[model samples]
Target: MPVRLPGPAVTEELDRVLGDRAAPGYADLRRLPYLEMVLKESLRLYPPGPYGARETAEPLAVGEYRIPAGTVVFYPFRAIQLNPDHWPEPERFRPERFTPEQVAGRARLAWVPFGLGPRSCEGAGPAMVECRLLLAVLLKRFRFRPVPGHRVDATERFVRWAADDIRMVVTPRKAGPPPRS
Candidate 1:
């Protein structure tokens, strides 16, 4: 999605933080705030794990009706994340919506790319770090352009999958000396 919706601001920020370096260190990754926002916004639009289920431990009241104990409750994360109520321009890819102030203004549970609560995925933190590091490295190393006539759609299974093959052309970046501090 980042490739499809390239933001000049994000690119400029990446270049500023990365300088002429081909790879980003931990500190460098931290400095790319816009890139982080882009990644999070991407996740918000298309979370890898789109749905989760939990069995009710006890009788629960939901609005007017009561759900009996042991009822399997499904959490449709994708739908929740895309709800227009929580996010303005829900379908549009806008990373600026994730600025610290904007995030703090929204409901605490509005963004749950990795699920929520104590039962949330244990690897969430590490997975985010890994994704940021790998994406930063790739963005630094190449420019991605979508291939003409390729179709990309979202499909749900155990995890969200692209419905069709996503074809992109990756052009290796020219090597240059790191920018002077």
Candidate 2:
């Protein structure tokens, strides 16, 4: 997915924001708003855990129908994230959708990449930090370009995965030394 996007533009943004900082501390990571947006949009489109199930503790009314207790309800993350009512051009990968203004305007649960409520993944925070740091450092060192003719599709299972191996050519980046202090 990274390879499919405008790699140079993203890399430029990372360089502009991070410079020669090999390690992005928590504070630094917080400042990389576009990077956060990219990650959020990616997670929204392809959540690792596509569906979550919860057994109702008590009878509930949804819309016009009543759901009995003990009914196993499935929350389809992909479907909800892709719903056109909430996301225009849902299939397109546009990280700007996660801008502060846009996010503030949306429903709180409009995007639930890490699930929601008490059952949400405990590792969500750490995982996001790890991903952002790794991506930042890696993008600083290398450029990933998709191999032509390689087909990448999201497959549904217990978790979402690439239907086939994603092929990308990684090229080492060549840039001048970081600006001196």
Candidate 3:
């Protein structure tokens, strides 16, 4: 199922980044480094989907083995993210891994949050902006914390989802007192 809403951490991160830069249509969301980091890390750890496939068109040598053309290949994003050769301390959630200079210097196709090549997600940019905006609005109004008896579990299907549903306590922020008229 679709998330339908942003998680609490995402919301908090956005607020921390935006601070006072509250503008409409994602103006405030892009200014946050930590928020971007969290997003990148989250995507790395748990991409929207489980895997992807491609058909090989020509004979190729993969790690000393020559496979004939026309073979179907599967790309497991989860495994790639956890590969020690590609990421250090793969299990840890570190957004700094996606720093501009760091990412630019990394191998191509290393981070495929929205897929790669010519068939990547067409809505990647807009979707990211939307996620940021949603998180910003939510963080400005409330805080989320895990409920006493519940934990978040995620499942991967066509798109990864919160397996047991995101059970959290949404405490609305107390508004400041108004000026005396």
The local distance difference test score of each candidate is 0.80, 0.81, 0.68
Q: Report the lDDT tens digits of candidate 1 across residue range 1-181.
A: 3235555565566677877766678877778888888889988888989787788999999999899999998889878889898899898888888899999989998898888888888998888888888887877777778887677887788898787767898898654544467
Candidate 3 has a TM-score of 0.77
Q: How many clashes does the backbone of model 1 have?
A: 0
User: What TM-score goes with each of the models?
Assistant: 0.89, 0.88, 0.77
Model 2: which ten-residue window has the lowest total lDDT? 1-10
The alpha-carbon root-mean-square deviation between model 3 and the true structure, to one decimal in Å, is 5.3
TM-score, cand. 2: 0.88
93-155, model 3: which lDDT tens digit per residue? 767788888788778777787777777789988887776566556666776766676766777
Give candidate 3 misplaced runs (Cα > 4 Å): 1-24, 174-181
Model 2 agreement with the true structure over 10-43: per-residue lDDT tens digits: 5666666677766567778876778788888888
RMSD of each: 2.5, 2.5, 5.3
lDDT of 3 at 132: 57
Q: Scored by Cα lDDT, where does model 3 land?
A: 0.68
Candidate 2: misplaced stretches above 4 Å?
A: 1-3, 176-181
